[model samples]
Target: MAVEVKYVVVRNGEEKMTFATKKEADAYDKMLDLADSLGEWLQQAPLNLDDEQREGLSFFLAEHKDALGQILRGAAPAEAPKKAAKVKMEKSVATSKEGSTSEKQAA
Candidate 1:
């Protein structure tokens, strides 16, 4: 027999998600709370957004809260995308080098 403990986040009597660790579950629940608040804020904005658009945008903002915070604090948003692409390319090159079949060429 095996023993397992899982943390579940439930909202409105529905199980939203389950996690192996309490930290992750708590983080997810907090993000949901942020998203809900953002949704309400969007409703009061002058720009007209449908329900789905507001919900999607709210979640996106919550998920990228750290990056958004940086932008809000005067960080240059344009720089991050190029740096992210470069890092991704570097990672791919490193992975390919590790799987190289021969000294002359990669597998």
Candidate 2:
């Protein structure tokens, strides 16, 4: 007699995929979960973003809409698109130590 182990991925009571290892199955499940979360978050994100952030995100999404669709649909592209550069903010603060004042700027 032989024993077999099955790693199954089930969604909505239907078997979606099977893997030989638990790790593979778990990774797939996590990916699906993350996609679902991302979809929900994207739907709600615009309301919370500032005008500049929204515009940047919108442009990025437009540029990568096909890749994003493929990812959300459970397909991986051969190469992921490069991320946009982050905007830098500079903050200036003045501090006084022992009757001496100095200003510091951080970016």
Candidate 3:
């Protein structure tokens, strides 16, 4: 006989998820909390939203909290870092040149 430990997240008297570790359960619970708060806030928006739409928008924002946080903090969306962009561009040029030479050889 073996005993297993599990963490379960329950919401409104229903079990939402089960996790092997408490950390994962806590993270999921936190996201749900954020979604709940966002849903309430959306109710105050001028645009009319049906209940389903508000719920969906709330979850979407909660799932992308990192990007939303940056925007809310007055930061513009970040572009790819210059060094990485340069490396990607170099790789693309090298590949295109290699393809042209290969085509010439085949011709």
Candidate 4:
């Protein structure tokens, strides 16, 4: 029912990465993309790195995400966003709270 990938960070030997399913893979990929963009954006405006260097860094990260993480990072490959079990519990709690609030307001 779920696809999972276990990855170890090369630089930080102790860091472990795991994704529950294809959706999780996709969410991670998007996260990587945003991080990459933010790095570039920072360099261009406030950071002011040269354009050539910026392009090179983007290319490098795009090419190397798999080595950085557990699997080859690409587009959102999963149909749904993979969420941690803890997040699911949090969502349930929030929903219950909202329901209770609604009942109180109705009363």
Candidate 3, residue 43: how far the Cα is off, in Å: 0.1
Q: Lowest-lDDT window of 10 residues in candidate 3? A: 75-84
The residue pairs found clashing in candidate 2 are none
Off by over 4 Å in 1: 77-107
Candidate 3 TM-score versus the reference? 0.66
Preferred candidate (TM-score higher): 2 or 3? 3
Comparing 3 and 4 by TM-score, which wins? 3
Model 3: colliding residue pairs = none
Q: Which is superior by TM-score, 2 or 4?
A: 2
lDDT of 4 by residue, 1-107 (tens): 98656543222354324565667656656655655685666575655577777766665666555444433343243412353456788999999999999999999
For residue 15, what is the lDDT in candidate 3? 100
Q: Model 1, range 42-105, lDDT digits (tens) per residue?
A: 9999988999999999999999898897799676677777777999999999988877746557
User: For model 1, which pairs clash?
Assistant: none
lDDT computed for candidate 1: 0.91
- The TM-score ranking, best first, is 1, 3, 2, 4
Which one is best on TM-score? Answer: 1
In candidate 2, how many Å is residue 58 off? 15
Give the CA lDDT, 0 to 100, for residue 107 in model 2. Answer: 17
Model 2: how far residue 97 lies from native, Å: 42
Candidates, ranked, lDDT: 1, 3, 2, 4
